[model samples]
Target: MTTYYRDGDVVITSTGIRMHGREYALAELRQVWHRSGRRSWGTIAGRGVLGLAMLLPILVGALGVGIALVAHASVAVTAGLVGGGILVGLAAAPLADVLLERVDRSYDRGSRRREIWGRTRHGDVLLLSTADAARFGRIYRALQRALEPSRVTR
Candidate 1:
């Protein structure tokens, strides 16, 4: 009669847990575990790209200032351009963070996965996974609570 967790695709009640159209009775659930996978190469590459994007502007600006100074531009102009370039580079930090966040979300949306496996008394395995960690945790913990016997008695 108690509802422990309910997400869009996963639900856990006192009687059972239902996920992705598959259901397992609480009394029959013998084991439940969370399985995590390794980070994908695409995620590593995306992080590298984001880091370079954050630093490239600053490096380019410094190179530009050096070139202008060597070309005999006035000290005042060089100084002003360097200051402006530094500001621009600082501005790019937030932009880079935003881009990194977007990339992370996109990868999570398309590729990230967390698996929850439940072994039933009948030797059947019920599996479910999702991209959202909080949601997955809710289902995982709920199932654990349902399977575990309560210590306190009325």
Candidate 2:
């Protein structure tokens, strides 16, 4: 079988999906849909605050140097601050990237919950539920791809 997505206890193939040991046939599902729960404002705001907190030192230092440079108080100070800023920025480049990535992930995962539901001949059923946006999107996309062939024939 062609595997579209596989991770942990979930797997989606050309035929259907097997998640946490339960199986659901693609043909059996009349419709598949996704819902993203309310965004966690507190979590998002906290992450934003944390990200700013992490960068506070850098910004403060830069601001100090910038003020000194604009004042033309001392040519030596300007040169020294500029060089130091470059060095510091370079040294923190990787860390800054990691921090940004973390904040981005926090926002992506800020949703309280995510769900995939399906309508079948029997009735509506809950197919998958998760708080991970990335994982939810991957699974939902895989399911859509698995259903593509069925759509074309009709």
Candidate 3:
């Protein structure tokens, strides 16, 4: 039988399975799932910087437009300025997209790690060998119980 235990409580029961104390069910888990793994914070930060780099051109173009307006440029020059601004903004779109894609790819890798951990049936199990195996066993058992179909206790 599968069972789940959380925070010293048994929150659910099905057949011979039981789930305890989880405020949220696995079915309700929706977010960037993360698992304990070896990771480099610097690499993650680098990806964030790349995303921000994509916005630089847009910011510069906006500043140019503001400067032109303040200077009371002629209509022809003002129109040209606006046109250039639009082009710059358009160009930035693809840059931002590429950077965001990279960031998303990194996140996808991390998410995959989490999925693997969750599937291992080890509760809060870290990837490291030093992690508590007993806790993971309990968690895995609880998860198993929670996932089991409910039984009618006639």
How do the candidates rank by TM-score, highest first?
Answer: 1, 2, 3
Q: Looking at model 3, which ten-residue stretch has the lowest summed lDDT?
A: 111-120
1 or 2, which is superior by lDDT?
2
Provide TM-scores for the models.
0.74, 0.71, 0.46
Q: Report RMSD (Å) for each prediction in the order shown.
A: 4.3, 4.1, 12.1
lDDT of 3 by residue, 1-154 (tens): 3334544433333332222322434443222122344565776677778867988889878977776687688998988888787788788988888888887766644421222122223344222121333444455555454554432111
Candidate 1 error regions (>4 Å): 69-71, 75-80, 103-112, 150-154
lDDT of each: 0.70, 0.79, 0.52
Candidate 2 lDDT, 1-154, residue by residue in tens: 7999999878999888887788988788788887888877887777877778667657766865686678666788888787776666565567777788888888676557899888878898888989888888888888888889867221
Clashes of 3: 14
Arranged by lDDT with the best first, the candidates are 2, 1, 3
Candidate 2 RMSD computed on C-alpha atoms after optimal superposition onto the true structure:
4.1
Compose the digit string of candidate 1's lDDT tens values, residues 19-103: 8898766766666777776656786677678778877877877776666667667888878877776776677778878877876
lDDT comparing candidate 3 with the true structure: 0.52
